[model samples]
Target: MEKKPNDVPKPNKENTISLEIAKDWTKRWRDMESTYNSHHDCRAFNIPLIDLQEVIKEQGVVSVRGYIGVEETVVEGDTVFIEKLIIVGVDANGKDMISSKDGLILDQESDDIYDFSDPCPNLCDPKSPLNG
Candidate 1:
């Protein structure tokens, strides 16, 4: 006899724990981004952090993009975790400016690309003339 799909055991505990951790981290990350955006003179510019829960619910995958700083990665078991994503913001003159921690993270499975590279030189520098 074949078991029904609903008979399969669901990893509820694991999923719940992962969701909680993701929520906590997302809040902290957004707070940090808000502070950085405020001081960088990009009041009009916005880089909304993508909601992983929503993405997972809608697309069954965690994919997001925005101005985040730095790109650090770590491998745990078979999964690779990327962090410190920096989003680009506009300068006082409404020109795009890249964060000092700009980098890229490409998800092969999802075909999602997170690009934070500074197209203009020294945009993250405080003393850079382009900052104006």
Candidate 2:
């Protein structure tokens, strides 16, 4: 007959107690912050900290272009994830002219070709820059 009992060591409560406490604390904190607060949207640096290459790849843009289309690219809710580098061209007037899988223009200050991490954080509205 094969031996069945006393082979495996029983888990000790001492090792797991702190881990359980930590988990419970984390859950309680999450619950405490669950209420709606205006400050949630004010987190300025909402960007993820990662390598530029990975960011670009995640955005599905091989290269950046100065323009999003014939008109200058404007920032909208749509173009939030594009990498800032890879813009290719710009029109005679100051406007981005290429379209990436991500969205409108990536960088704003730069008309020259270079890599950037963030897209146009602030863009003038193409429809009416003055009114909007």
Candidate 3:
């Protein structure tokens, strides 16, 4: 009746990052941030499958791409522009796929940009085998 990390789906071997490697990389990032006293509790982003599906439903969108960004927010009373992952739809040409209702370049500000994915350390899979 309770969920645990093992409840999370196992990584696909095709492009999987091993548990050891993931831990190492995360540790490196934390170490660097700790030196500056800017350590964050976040470790990953949770992009739901349904949200990703919605992005790819747009015309000409063949895939989604994630970019690292920074935005000012308070963490334990410290204002910081923490690194966040922003996901955007990508067209076949590898361009950010923005839609035009009139089939033209102009569109509303809410076009195809997506963010606000739930960050980890809170939403992460508990005790995941992959060290999530």
Candidate 4:
């Protein structure tokens, strides 16, 4: 398996970004797209620490990785494409722990991929400074 999201050779507690940098990057995304932070764009997602711990508790999982993705959805009776963050378990070698069966390529619908994060704008902290 190859490291796709982080692109690192191995996992060792890296990939931490400062809050100010995160805020700026999020702000840039919000400013770059008109739909960002709006009904058409998915700004962020929230996952509980306890829930994330469950994924991390898997054997050989050393870190979690996230990938940007899009899904077909409808809002206000209109079809739309909203971005989402697809998180998954990463092994010590920095490879995604995607589940496979019978030696076949990983299926997109595999239950190992964690994509149930609560989307923002509808379920967000209105008072949080990170909402920008």
> Clashes in each model (backbone N, CA, C under 3 Å)?
9, 14, 0, 0
- Which candidate number has the best TM-score? 4
Worst 10 residues of 3 by lDDT: 13-22
Which tens-of-lDDT digit does each residue in 1-132 have in candidate 1? 343232222353221212222333345556666465444433222223342332234333333334433222334534222233332233345543322222222223322222323322223445556555
Best by lDDT: 4
Model 1, TM vs. native: 0.23
Kindly state the number of residue pairs that clash in model 4: 0
lDDT winner, 2 or 3: 3
After superposition, candidate 3 runs with Cα above 4 Å error: 1-38, 74-83, 99-106
Q: TM-scores across all candidates?
A: 0.23, 0.15, 0.54, 0.56
Among all windows of ten consecutive residues in candidate 4, which has the lowest summed lDDT?
3-12
Please report, in order, the local distance difference test score of every candidate based on alpha carbons.
0.33, 0.29, 0.52, 0.53
Q: How do the residues 39-97 of candidate 3 rate in per-residue lDDT, one tens digit apiece?
A: 45667777777767766676777888875444444557665444445566787898865
- Write down the worst ten-residue block by lDDT for model 2: 65-74
Which has the better TM-score: candidate 1, or candidate 4? 4
The TM-score that candidate 3 achieves is: 0.54
